[model samples]
Target: MWQFLKTWYHRLASPKWFYHTSGRWLPYLAAVTILLLVSGAIWGLGFAPEDARQGNSYRIIYIHVPVSVLALVGYYLMAVAGAIALIWKIKLADMVMVSAAPLGAVLTFLALLTGSIWGKPTWGTYWEWDARITSMLVLLFLYLGVLALSRAFTSRDTAYKACAILSLVGTVNIPIIYKSVDWWYTLHQPATIKLTGGSTIHPAMFKPLLVMIIGFYCFYALVLILNTRAEILRREQRSAWVRELI
Candidate 1:
């Protein structure tokens, strides 16, 4: 079992192996991503019943909630990849970290944008300096900082190390973002979904949300894999395997 695990990790850490392996899976992933996203979007936005309170405006939850969840989860993935690159000096991990930055930034931006839109009706304002919203804004800047620092250094190793440390340091904000609504009185509502206790949401509404969340997760993985593949090809352009594939 240990040997099998080690072999799997070794293959995963290998750029050439990942490049070839990902190619075979990309088509299937793309198909699944498209199908789920389309179905979930249509179901959630068009078919799901309106909320008792928020009415049609609440429909934005279909996109807002899913992207907000993805944004936080993506930040964690970015931080973990950065930590792996720094701790193990893994080139593949570094590539994953770099590729994750911009994608995470976009997701964060979407989260903020959609949240602001959702807030207009619910909170009677489009913008608020509440703890949750402010911390989320900081999260966006953290992602952008990683992107900026990566390009600031001429030395690749220096850039990777810098981004790694920045990502790790920025992780402090994640918990702050998660707990901001609880830590202080804020316009943002407390979480409807809970891990331990049963969810506050009705199952009828939650089912389409579940589908959207799953579809969003698949979409995130699809983007990450494609981005990492592009980064790998560019970084490994001079390698024999990359040359042969080209």
Candidate 2:
């Protein structure tokens, strides 16, 4: 079993293998992303009960929470890829790290945007320098910083090392973002989903939230696969395999 798992890891570590395999997965992932997103949107927006206080405005959580969660998760992916590239000197890992940065930034932006939209009605303001939101904004800048650092260098190797170090260093803020509401007085509420206990949301609402989260994950995977594939093609354009395919 260990041998088989090791072999599988080696295969996945190859960019050519990953590119070809991901082509086969693209269709299936796209279908699942569409199905789950459409179903979750309908269920969360139309069927879920309105909040007693926030009312219809609470429906934004379906979009806001998922994007926000994935934004944080996406940063971790970039950091991990950067770490792998640094440790192994894997070109493929560097590509993955670079590909993930823009997406992470975009997700962070959406989270902040949706959160702002949700906030206007709930907090009587469009923007606030609250702890959670401030940390999240910092998260966006971190992603952008990785991206800018990558391009700033003319040498690809130098860029990879710099981005990897920056990504690893920036991870300090993630815990800060997670603990911000608990540590500080803020309008942003603590997480409804808990690690030690069941979620605080009602069953009716929780089910759709769960579905939306799953949908967002599927969507993120699909986008990442596509992004990686594009990067592979661009970087390997002169290679025989890419040339043959082209």
Candidate 3:
């Protein structure tokens, strides 16, 4: 079993092999993402019960919470990809990191926008300088910085290294974003649904929240796969495999 696993791992380390394997999963992931997102949106927006405090306005949580969560996760993914590219000199890893940046930025922007919309009704204001919100804004800027720096250099190698370093440095902001509410006084509420401890939200709201979270993950997977495939094609355009596939 160990030998077989090691062989498979080595195969996956090859860009051509990884591309072919990813191709097999792409359609399925895309389909599942669409299905889950549509279903979750319909259920959450139309069928879910209104919040006791915020009423119908809280329905935005379906979008806001999911995007917010994905923004953080996406950054970590980009950072890990950057590290792998820098340490192992994997060209594909660098491509993945580069491809992930724009998507992460979009997600972060959506989170901030939706949060602002949600806030107007709940907090009686469109924006606040709360720690979590401020940290997320910083995260958005970090993502932009990585993207900008990656393209700033004429040499792809130099650009990749610079972006990787930026990603690693930006990772510090993620923890600050997560712990902002806990570590400091802030208007943003504490986590309502605790995975290990206890949940403050009732089961009715919790169910849709879970569904939306799953839907968001599926959406991210779908987008990442598409973006990564495009990156591979762009970077490997002159390669025999890409030529043959194209």
Candidate 4:
């Protein structure tokens, strides 16, 4: 078992091996992602009950909650991939980290936009400098910084190293973003979906929210795999395998 695990781990460290493995999983991941997203969207948009307070506007939770969660998870993933790339000099790891950045930025933007939309109906305003919201904005900026820094250097090796360091440094912002609501009194409500305290939200609303979160996670995996594959192709363009495949 140990030998098997080590072999698999070492295999993944190779760009070609990682590319082929990811390719095998891509179709399955994509199919599941689409299935979950469509199912969740239909359920959330069509069947979920209207909020007693916010009415139809609360329906945006389907997109808002999932994207917000992904913003944090995505950053962590990029940082971890960066760490792996730096430590092992694994081309696949660097590619995964690079591919993750734009997607993370987009998710952060969606979260902020949807939050604004949800806010107008509930808070009677489209924007506020609340702790949660402010921290989220900062998180978005961090994503941009990593993306920019990664492309700034003339040498790819130097670029990857610089981006890796920046990614590690930026990880500090994630905890700040997560705990901002707890540390500061904010207009944004405390977690409605708590594990131990019992969810403040009704079960009807909660169900679709869970489904949507899962769907969004699946979607991220799908995109990440596809993007990683593309990066592999580009990086290995000179290789016999890539040339033959192309």
In the range 1-246, model 4's lDDT, one tens digit per residue, is: 999999989887887887888888888888888888888888889999988877888889899999999999999999999999999898888999999998999999999999998998799988999999998999899899989987898898998998888889999989888778778977988778866777789899889889889989999988888888888888889999888775
Off by over 4 Å in 4: none
Largest lDDT belongs to which candidate? 2
State each model's CA lDDT, in order: 0.90, 0.92, 0.89, 0.89
Model 1 TM-score is 0.97
User: What's model 1's lDDT at 237?
Assistant: 95
Candidate 2: which stretches are off by over 4 Å?
A: 1-3
Total clashing pairs for each candidate: 0, 0, 0, 0
TM-score, candidate 3, is 0.95
Show model 3 residue runs off by greater than 4 Å.
Answer: 1-3
User: Model 4 misses residue 74 by how many Å?
Assistant: 0.6
When superposed on Cα atoms, how far off is each prediction in RMSD? 1.0, 1.1, 1.3, 1.3
In candidate 3, list every pair of residues with a backbone clash.
none
**lDDT per residue as tens, model 3, 38-123:** 88888888988888778899899889889999999999999999999999898888988998899999999999999999899889
Prediction 2 global C-alpha lDDT: 0.92
